[model samples]
Target chain A: MLSTQENAIIIEDLKKSFKNLEVLKGVDLTVRRGNILALLGPNGAGKTTIIRILSTLLHPDNGNVFVNGFDIKTQPQEVRRSIGLTGQFADVDEYLTGLENLLMMGKLYHLSRSVITRRTEELLKKFDLTEAARRPVKTYSGGMRRKLDLAASLIAYPPIVFLDEPTSSLDPRSRLNVWETIKKLLNDGVTVLLTTQHLEEADFLADTIAVINDGRIIAEDTPGRLKSRVGKERLELVIKRQDDFERAVTVITGNDLSHNSAEKTVSLAIENGVNEIQGVLNQLAESGIEVDTLTLRKPTLDDVFMHFTGLKPDEGRNEAA
Target chain B: MNSQLVYKKAYWMAGDVWVLIVRSIKHIYKNYDQLLGLTIQPIMFMLLFRYVFGGAIVVDTGTYVNFLMAGILVQGLAFGSLTTSFSIATDLQRGIIDRLKTLPIASWAVMMGHVTGDLVRNGLQAFILISMGILVGFQPTASALEWIVIAVLIVLFTLAISWIAAIMGLLAKTIESVSWLGFLVIFPLSFASSAFVPTETMPAPLRVFAENQPFTHVIEAIRALTLNRPVGNHLWMALVWCFGIILVSIPIAGYLFRRHGGR
Candidate 1:
């Protein structure tokens, strides 16, 4: 529905199949430069397949991928040059000291010995990892390895970087630390293409969010816009009397009641405004349905994802997004 | 920071594989105890076969250690080179390769790094084996220039065998499976060539097969240098054998490496 020429990453009609399984079926993605494009998807939704193609690790059976205005198939090395990828599990060599991992990446990027050395120190300071720089990576905590992984990717500071669930396994505080680093990168004008299943992550970091389900994008919008699609906030109530509940449903359903179930004891969905609650109580009081409970809140992104995908992701894929 | 910097940085990464080489070395250094077997196992084989079995078999009327050690050195390289291939397989199984696969430098650099690293490793094993043989009274008969010829011959043979091992590593479905599969190559080559004794001591038909084998010529070429004997037609034959393995194994390994990962 939209097109951008100067985009950092553009994927069109991308289809990839393995043997009999069609992992990605006609997917399209366009990531604006310098913005964090959050690719949110449930497990097995072909998120990694998409990332691999964009990063030039895999090729699509059909369609074209353009990274920094270069075709991935024809100019893969150039595409690779324009992007850095940090995978689901940070595959830093565990035997190497954390400092050595970053330095090694800097060297692999072909910075001069002096340049790689400089970048190594800079990244260590930036990631707040200098304190543990000499420790073997295996000794570092999950969060530290992730931080080191991020620091290593920035050795060359490619314009676009792909982070595959860089924070999925992190504890809240460490996750927050990673978020701060990502924010710093954004401030530095680095474009991040992040694939994550955490709705909160997308909410906290995304400039745009695309919800993928069953190998296709089901929805794409700003986080707030996606949440708003779940409809107006409401007070849900379960009462004692069935007749009174029926009456309450009739009364509340008369207004802005979004698809509720009255079959259960006294359930009434009403817009979550005080006026609406007061209006429902007056109607319920007249019908003699003694109210048991009532609560009101705005819908969460979980609700939005649940609504669109028809089911919430019951099992999170432990691997990075 | 800018497009100019990105390509420039990636261009530079390819030239700095030494850091990765160092990392590989450090990994080995850390696990020094575990690799003691890699360094010493071949030495034990040399001592045992050179002493116990040495006098039993004769190839060209020389110290059997000198003759058989040539073949043993060839066999040792063939054995040691598989470690490189298996290490690649292990890296893949451990998801290490997956991380490197996404890096910005030349994608093929990972394979190159592994191959170079393996050559270093194979070179070490060859040196240790050669040094031990030198200590056991094995002397070089060839002059310095001829010695260089034999060293070049050994390097080529090792490279070819390493490529085949690399192919096996890439195609095997599981790391454990590949590790076990690689051992199969070692046995036949070691037993069928002049590595343990000499091709002459074998039963007639077995001797014919042994003499016809590429490894037989490789060992013969090494034997000629060690004893300062005339390098029979086997010298040319050894070079041809090494080139043949390289021609066949490289494309096969390259195809499989790309098939498994170059996607």
Candidate 2:
């Protein structure tokens, strides 16, 4: 038996393979109670595989997973009782009304009839789906469907929830709406494990971010610390003339600068971006080099991701998405 | 786990199955056109065989319409149960099965719910065909008690075939494939058997295969029951076939349902 002090989820040396492709390779993760752990990765990086194993939707080839004090392999029913899963695609029945969907989930959870009714209303209202609650979900907008999916997961209020790319394929405004809904889960003290390829999503929503690549967690830390590992800030200079790029590179030397000849730009990692930009500008001005644009960029999760994975976060994602 | 906890879990599974059944039935109700189309096909077949082809094809039974009604009900129930495959395939495609698997209820509940719902729908289809048969100058000479037994037999046969449909739905890669698979099996079984035409009119080899199949026994049994004739060995054969299907398909459907995650 596990106590409440134990982590909400513990996965150790987890491995899974689908036919010829090895999806998860010896993954180890611990999500603390009442916190959000974002499994950040590009497409086919084993993020969904890991989420499926943890949620007991798919079995692992080897290793152990414990969710909310129960083993996922042997005590899957108990684990299921304690965890709610919102899959990548919305899982609510499109033929059922939004209210009926929630009620169905509540009944599946074995909640009493009266409690199911109350919770159904509460969740519909909480997700701001009260107006569309009576309509079949096929008539709902994409964002409404997502909200209903999330609400269905919360029907029983499980201590842990798995959001597998919950906001994928949604418009920007809808994505923000989902992000706000996820934020409310934090206040309710639910342990959330979300997967996303969106670096901005991880930076904004995750309390701890696990960077996965090639079926392994390459880096794991808070969003801020992960960004700091790459650099504090970036200094970007777009030279007006291609001829002046070589001279600008010399002035920006010793600052770990990289030049893109095609774009006529040079970027460098800097500790004090403002000071470094001023120094580079003065030096370039002295050499009679024209500058088109000069700016300091705060290090984003993309930089941290690239620094760890040696590939752009969006490199192999567009085709898959 | 404690016995009480196990009981509670079983109770939850039962409740979950009920919810899924209601959901499926409500979907069928909302798509009443599809239901109407399904129920109408058997009635049309009954009319075609009774009026259109009745004069040419002769059977030893008292009235050809009486002989055709039993086979029509069996064929209709078999075809009605095919909806189980289509609906299950749709649920698998839509990720509803994946969502249900993650819940605390028994995994078998998903398939059971589907079969149960199809069983109800099959019952309704049987009723519609029987009512139409009565309206078209057909009569059953069996007593009320035997009629009840015939109804029970139809329901049992439908329940068994539904398990097979569940397996097809689970094994199918696409929704369209499910329909094709159902057609591949149901069409051969219903047409080649004595559902529409008697086996004597067929060639000897085809006659042997048709007479030996489960659909022939079920149709023969239902024909005997409704005509107040001795059931002979066909009733036992029908019961055996129904039990055999349920015995073989329940485990296979459960395994395939578990295997086919939202893949």
Candidate 3:
């Protein structure tokens, strides 16, 4: 058992329902202090619901949750004092200038007016919003709005932060910029619980990835361990001709292989990376099965997702959308 | 010791409410179009009533403008209360309420801030409309004390209506739906009461409704106070309606806010 000081968040059999739909069915999760735990899942997998419950916005019908050693249900005010929430949407007043928004949040947190003024200036500079501090948020770009929202959350400098898909809607360049900002938070020893549908985001940023599906966390492990659990590597060959594709499929004896006739490619899950590729090429050469190209690929987060959920990531996206 | 803790809690709650009130007021200032509409609409109503409908109507009082003054002021307040609904609905739609809820501030502060902001705004509108009334041949015979009492009555009425508007904002699914819902409530109350004309001139059933409703009692209380008429049961009835609304609407709005207001 971990001490409360070492754990940033703990959920014991948390359950919630909206009408007849049970969004979070008896689930337990934990985040260690100063670590980033990414809730990696597709849409409507209850990722946002879990964040909502931990943030004290939505009440759980059953179970207990603790944030920074405070009970979420009984001591919500203390929990709020210890944590900041950045929701999926950037929740800032469009009519107010960026500086006013941060100052308002600071005041609500019970900071002194002088402290609010000082912190607002520091945060605006830190988030690269100093030039736009006096401009209303309605005129801000989407990325700028998100940056201001994040700045608002950090005004009080809480020990824990909950980010619900902080970069889900940003372009690639802005997404990378947000990633850098999150890394800086980690350097400050802030415990972060982030949710994202993008596999690369979880793989790149999360210390531990929790794969959730249908309101359940199917797998929770380090990114390396999760990927390795699915398999070692894959060998994919693009055959040059249609007749050779059929011959190549016949020569590869393993049942762990799949072929696409349109792409004229065969992908095989392999235990040995380099040796497996060599053996496959030699076998195809012997069978007069000409190969256009061959390459070895490591197991990606996508494969880990499919292995645990039994559904491709894109399929889950379509169903939820 | 217990009293000290209660005082401390009250102090912090007041602080939170004040901060949020400032935010709400800033929103009003920034949206100059809304500010303009608040001023322009009442002036238009005053002109239309003083010119178009002034000559045709007859009252036992000094003049038609004097009889129409209190009704116009109440009408402006009723319309101004809809801004409460619209602002609250916009906040909920934009997820601002959710952000406020997650903070460590008092839970009731958001609604209080919005309600208090409406009081300030409606008070200003009432002042403007009264000036317009005086300019258009409307006369008042009230003393200094009577003017103070009239101001208090107006404040209480605004508080009551603003709470109801807050409830509408919470219940309506969309901002557009909130306006439609507000119109459905405000249009009938302002029109069916003694706002635009006397209730005695109406037919049997309509006159009964027009005479007995809360708005009629409120408008009549203000009218009698301003015109130096005999103080009647209208004053007490108006107080009952105002307190009753404030008492009832507060809990329902608070309940809906806690249950569905997001975390």
TM-score of each: 0.79, 0.88, 0.88
Q: Residues A59-176, candidate 2, lDDT per residue (tens digit)? A: 8999878899888889988898998889674388887899889988998888888999998888888889999999999999888898899999999989999999989899999999
- List RMSD in Å for every model shown: 5.8, 3.7, 3.7
Per-candidate DockQ vs. reference: 0.39, 0.46, 0.53
- The C-alpha lDDT values of all candidates are 0.75, 0.84, 0.85
* Candidate 1 regions with alpha-carbon error over 4 angstroms: A1-6, A61-64, A73-75, A112-115, A169-176, A228-305, A312-321, B1-35, B50-64, B90-105, B136-142, B200-205
Docking class of 1: acceptable
| Candidate numbers sorted by TM-score from highest down | 3, 2, 1
Task: Name every residue pair that clashes in candidate 2.
Answer: none
List candidate 3 segments past 4 Å from native: A224-303, A313-321, B1-4, B261-263
Model 2: CAPRI class: acceptable
Q: After superposition, how far is residue A259 of candidate 2 from its true place, in Å?
A: 6.5
Best-fitting candidate, scored by TM-score:
3
Superior by DockQ: candidate 2 or candidate 3: 3
Number of backbone-clashing residue pairs for each candidate, in the order shown: 4, 0, 1
**Model 2: DockQ score:** 0.46
Candidate 1 lDDT over A1-321, as tens digits, reads 334356888888889887767777788888887888899876777888888888777878998778888888898777766777785733778778998888777766656788888888888998999999998888998888888888877888788888988898789999999888888898878888898877778878999999876667778898877655664564667776666656666665433343334443332234456776787778878767787777676654455556676465654222322
